[model samples]
Target chain A: MRSSFVSFTLNGEEKELLIAPGQRLVDVLREQCGAMGTRNGCGQGGCGACTVHVDAVPMLSCLVLAELAEGCDILTIEGAARDRTLHALQEAFVAEAATQCGFCTAGMIMAAKALLDRDPAPQREAVVEALSGNVCRCTGYEPIIAAVLAAAAMLARLPAAAA
Target chain B: MTRLRGRGISAVNYPTGMNLGGDPSQALIHATTTGNFVVTLSSVDLGQGLRTIMTQIAAEVLGVPPESVIIDTADTDTGPHCMGTFASRATHRIGNAIIMAATEARNALLDVAGEELEVAAADLETDGDGRIAVKGVPGKSISVLDAALAAHFKYGRTISGRGIYLKPRSYPDFETGAMDPDSCQAHACTIAEVEVDTETGEVRVLKLTSAYEIGRALNPMMVEQQIVGGSWMGMSHALYETTEPYYPDRAHGPVDFAEYLMPGPADIPQYDAVILERPSASGPFGAKGIGEMTANSPIPAIANAIFDACGVRIDELPITPEKLLRALDAAAVAPRR
Candidate 1:
């Protein structure tokens, strides 16, 4: 495997790392960066547990090669919180009780966050579409939908806050 | 409450005279091979909220807050032996054992409290926050932590409880393959309305309304999520999702999010969820499971909806456009009933 040096902005901090060819971005994030919050339920990328924002757009980290994501803006679940406070979506998830084992939580939140970032006032259908990729075995979708809608409402009030 | 009893089949039918000590304290403690709490039988959560429910039951029994309880499902060796995740029995069976064990521990603490407070055990109650209160006395109270401390100091015993539960066997008859063997039964009804394209045979689910009788919803928010997730899974299974098999090894089917055709926001219709709360006779706080039921109704409901929209009945799951076209073509030649 050819080791290539890759640099990217993760969460907010810029970091440089060596990545082997064919290395999944999910593996690099989990194994290299120690971000266990981004889970890999189905390595094939059918499940959205490994979803992360690449340049502010929700993309499946499992399918993306680490080399391809170099120099791109990346955001993982670990970065969703600012300082000690959790993102609005995370708090909404807790309030709505949308998490069970919490494996899919990070990806689900990221996907919803991306949707809300792009459209601060997403309709119910838009929220559902944005999260369609992420698969959660728990909280059927009602609480998740409720959480996304609630988070959007909360985020709408805070114009100065960064999503 | 109605009790249903049946004889169980065993290769070696042990006589009823076997020395089986029946003690509430002993019967309640569920211990795995590792001797820690074995509250859930399943490894895969599938979003039924069993972990939270188990924790709540354990804390309630042990006289602690729901947050104070911790759940570990990391390894099968260290925890109790489980049957793996399926059929939504975690909350019903494991929660019961945890509650039983916790109740035993609470009673042990109350035994000490009975002496210190000079009150009968029946006169004391534990509140939602695990605070012990004397009946008919508004201000008099004791925290569960203080009770445990006092009990340890006075009796030289720790405040803890454990329980293990095995449901009575109920299997299918040999002559007729009928199984009422499930420990618990959950029922749900779903109605779907869809719009179908006559030319392409594409069917879009317009709206889905589902109502379920889940005994009781311990956490309403959690229950809603469970239903919604299950509904989406069912929708995917019914209309779009599939795992294509290749003989020697299964290739990466739906390898990426773009290729995997799950119901997007435009695809998923409006959802109207109705929760029917009926306390089960045997469950903790009258709670029954609601994890897998959402997947059960979608196939039939969507198929029924397809017939409603267009005069076609596609039987197989994931009624994709290609499959629907074939069904539509076949229907054209077949005699109209």
Candidate 2:
């Protein structure tokens, strides 16, 4: 087994850590970097509870190797807030009460954030498609979808600089 | 192109708490000198928002804002005894206990405030804004923070309360086999609309609509979320998920979420719910159990819908396409009028 020091930017902070060759990025973020918001549901890529953004693209952290994330900017749910203020998506989720049991909430919100970042004015169908990979067993996805749509509306109204 | 569509309905009722033995839950409530109340419980919040709802219950009873209540559901070793969070019991058992404990703590606070204001405890009432004032004269008031401090430093009385709610077990008569088993019952009626393709034997659940007699919805938003999640689980159990594809054999079973087929966001149907509030006599704020029952009605309703569409009764679990196709083939050969 080969292990090397991998340098990457996590939640806007530059970090370099030793990683096992087969160590999944999810383990590095959670076990090493102390990012507990990323949950491991099935370990396989099936359940998207470990979803994170790798250079603005939503990828299951459980499937991506830590080595592959070297030099890439990683964003987890902990980074979703700015200056202790909830992101528009986070606020919308709270207002809509989209979270239940909160196990998959961080992943669901991360997936939604990716969708909103790509297409700020996504329709209902698009929102559903984006979150198709994330499995929430506590399972109230309707309110979650509504919350994403609401967040999009909220974001669209924000000043260009704030958005 | 021409898929057969059918609708089926199922009505069900579930008990609020466990019926086996004495199901009990305890709460410890204490007023802090800072004017906030802390509720410590052992019941786990498995995302059903028990912490939030318990806080609401305590705040309502203590005559303070919901923010003034802090719920600490620590591990069992440190907290009091609870029957755990199952059988839809958290809200009913825990809510009742919190109300009891909050009331006791509130009385203690009022007692301290009454002495400070030179009035009897009966003459004092909380204004729901953290102030205890004389009933006739609103100006004669003292903050709860002040009273809490006085009670601790001057009176040397710890403003603390403890509560426990126990459901007495009923033993069945050996001769009659009759017993009242549960504290209360919650009811739901679900209607499922599904489409079936004869060739593929694929069932697509289009919509799941239901009306639940929830006793009372302490928080309607959380209730709706639970219903949505539970209904999806029921749908998965009906048409998608399977632990044993080779029923009697243990050769090839799904080991992960990919192998196990659960419904994703794409499969979510149009869910509509109508909440009917008929407060139960024993429930907390009239809230009966809705967590477990939310997943109950949808299962039978979906099964019945598959039968209605293709006239094939899937007695086994997860009315799979292979089974439905076999039944459809058998039905085609018989052509019963």
Candidate 3:
């Protein structure tokens, strides 16, 4: 295979890495970028455990080729926190006991993050629809929905500056 | 024709540990110079929060806050031998061992503190705030940290303990067919409601209401997660999951998540769970092993509901549409298209 060079902003940090031709973005992010928090659950697009924010959009890194990420801004689970405090979604997940096994948590949080960013006050069905791609084999998705709603309320309660 | 609705219930008794040559688990506890307790175990967590629960058990026994106790399930080299994690026996077996070990560690801590305070070991009790105080005399107390320091440097004694729990293998009385094979048994019942389409042979589960009599829910939240997830697995096994649709052909096995069948978000049914706790005789703080049984009852419950809906029984896993249509035709319940 051919070698390719790519540069992207990851978690607000500028990153430049070498990649092989046709390599998956997920593989490059995990292997080269050392973004181990972005788990590779299925390696295919079916399982959304490798979800990452590309240009502020939730995209399945497993399906996207590494070359496609050139000059793109990527955000991973590691970026979900500010300073030492956890993101509101992370706090809600812990409070609601939504991250049981934690395998699907990063991707689940990323998906929820995207939804919360798009619609800060999502309804219950809307939260379910947003998280449809993310599969949590634990908690039966009940606590997950509750966590998203709880996060939404928390965001709503926060002042304009902190949010 | 409109869809037919039916409800069915299933009850099952599940045993705790697999008593294979006396199932056993061991735990070790030691205190650092700063009085932070460390618990070592070879049994893995597998994301089930075993370390967290074990830490809570140890802290309770040692009379320290959970944050002051750390659980180390990391290398087997430093941990004690275990029978591995299976049969839902980690909490029940390993927990009991930790209780014993922590009790001993607590004794050692109290003894060291008693020596430092010039009081009897039995007269001192942990105050749950990093201090050991004499019974009924809260003013005269010594910080566990200082006692631990004294034990290491002054007394030259290691404040540590080891523990193990075993439910020995029992043989049946062949004449009467009586045997005590398990330490304890937990019970579960699930009620499933489903809707079946006569035209398309499609079955959709509407809701699952379940009740569990797990000896004790050490963490109710964790128990709820296990129950709901296990029931989903049961539903998947009852209707969707199949590794070999065309068995013996071997050409069409699933290669990845795309080919494999599982219930996705849209496919989930409403899950309701109720937990009842009856402390066990030999459990660690009245907690029993209840990880696997939550998946078992839902399978039979779903199968029975489908039968009640269309007067057909599909014992085979998946209860695929093809088999359902065939069974419906044989029963003359198939609506004429």
Candidate 4:
């Protein structure tokens, strides 16, 4: 097995890690970076419980090779909160009671964040399309969809500075 | 040339709690030195908010705010015995036990406060905000924190309680086959509408409207979540999911999510649900369990909808396109003579 050193900006922090050829990004994020929030539901790219943002795009970390993600800007659910306050999306999720069991919460929030960041005023169908990859066995995706839309509306109302 | 639309409805009822050897659940409650209540149980919260629901029930019984109540679940070695989380028994069984335990702890708390206030224990009342006072005088009150401290150190009393809920076993009359196995029952009614393509025999669910008589909803949001997830599972089982493609052939089956079929976002239909609250006499706070029963009605409802859309009575698990097409062919030749 070949192992090499890889560097990437994770959660806005520039860090380097020792990675092997087969080590996935989910493994490094959970084992090395200590980001337990990024849950590993399925090792395959299926469940979407290991979703993370690479260059502000939601990608299944389980499918991404750790070495190939070098030099990329990675964002995780641990970074969703800023300055001890939850992100708008996280607040909406709690307010709407969108999370149950909390296993898929981080990935679901990260996916919603990418959608809201790209399109602040997404329609209901667009929100549904955005969350197609993620799987939430609880809450039936209705509250999650409502929470994402609520977060979008909240962001729309916020001042540019706060946003 | 055009798709045919049809609607169907189904109603189902399920018993709450498995009565195997008189299924029992136990709870332990104690007052912390910081004037808080802790509920310990072995019942696991498998994402259905069992902890939150149990905490709410304990707080209600203990006469304290919900924030002051903490619930610790799924520790079997230290916690009391629970019959596990299946059979939709977590809320009903565990809740009854917590009420018993919290009531005892509340009595202990009042005893200590009564001594501090120089009032009879019967004359004391709790304000649900961690305070105990004389029945008519709110001004002369002592914080629960002080009462707990005095009880522990000065009075040498540990405020704790233990409880268990057991349904009495009833032997079935073997000749008549009459027996009451469950303490309570929950009901669900689902109406499903679907569109079927005649050419491809593909069926797509358009909308689902359901009414659930869930005894009482301890947390309405969580109940609704369970219903929605259960409905999706029902739809998946009816139309999309199948591991055994060819029956009796064990060699071929879907191994992963890619091959296995479950409903995704694109397959979800517009869902409308109405929760009917009918308090159960035996359940805690009139709330019955709604976990497994949520998926019961939608399977038959979907099958009925397919039949209503096209007059093809395909008595099978999944109304597959191939089966539907074959049924349509047989119906066309016979044409309901």
For model 2, residues A1-163, the per-residue Cα lDDT tens digits are 8799999999999999999999999999999999999998878888788999999999999899999998999999999999998999999989988888777888899999999998999999999999998887875588889899999999999997676
lDDT per residue as tens, model 1, B1-337: 1111111111111111011222111123332222133333334354566667667677666655666555665666555555555556667666666676677767776766666677887788877575777977846777665666676665676555656655655455899977445545567878877777777767777677778788888877677767676677777888887655324565655445546666654455677778988787777788877766677676678777776666676777778887877877888899469
Tell how far residue B240 is off in model 2, in angstroms.
1.5
User: Which CAPRI category fits model 2?
Assistant: medium
True contacts reproduced, candidate 1: 0.56
The recovered share of true contacts, given per candidate in order, is 0.56, 0.82, 0.60, 0.56
Best by DockQ: 2
Candidate 3, B44-155: lDDT as tens digits: 9887789888988998899988988988889777679899888988999999999999989999999999999999999998878788999999999999899999999999
Give the Cα lDDT of each candidate.
Answer: 0.70, 0.89, 0.89, 0.88
lDDT tens digits, residues B103-205, model 4? 8999999999999999998898888888888999999899989999999889999888898999877779999989889989999999999998988988899
Ten residues in sequence with the least summed lDDT for candidate 4 chain B: B244-253
What fraction of the true interface contacts does model 2 reproduce?
A: 0.82
lDDT of 2 by residue, B1-337 (tens): 4599999999998888887878889999998878889899999888888998998899889988888889998889999898999999999999999989998998998899989999999898888888889998999999988998999899999888898999988899999999888899999999999999998888899999999998999999888888888898889888888866764566667666677788888888999988999999999999998999988899899889988887888888788889888998999899768
lDDT of 3: 0.89
Docking quality level of the chain pair in candidate 1? acceptable
After superposition on all C-alphas, the RMSD of every candidate to the true structure, in Å, is 8.9, 1.7, 2.3, 1.8
C-alpha positional error of residue B188 in candidate 4 after TM-score superposition, expressed in Å: 1.9
What pairs collide in candidate 4? none
For residues A36-79, write the lDDT of model 1, one tens digit per residue.
Answer: 99998788767788999999889899999999988899999998
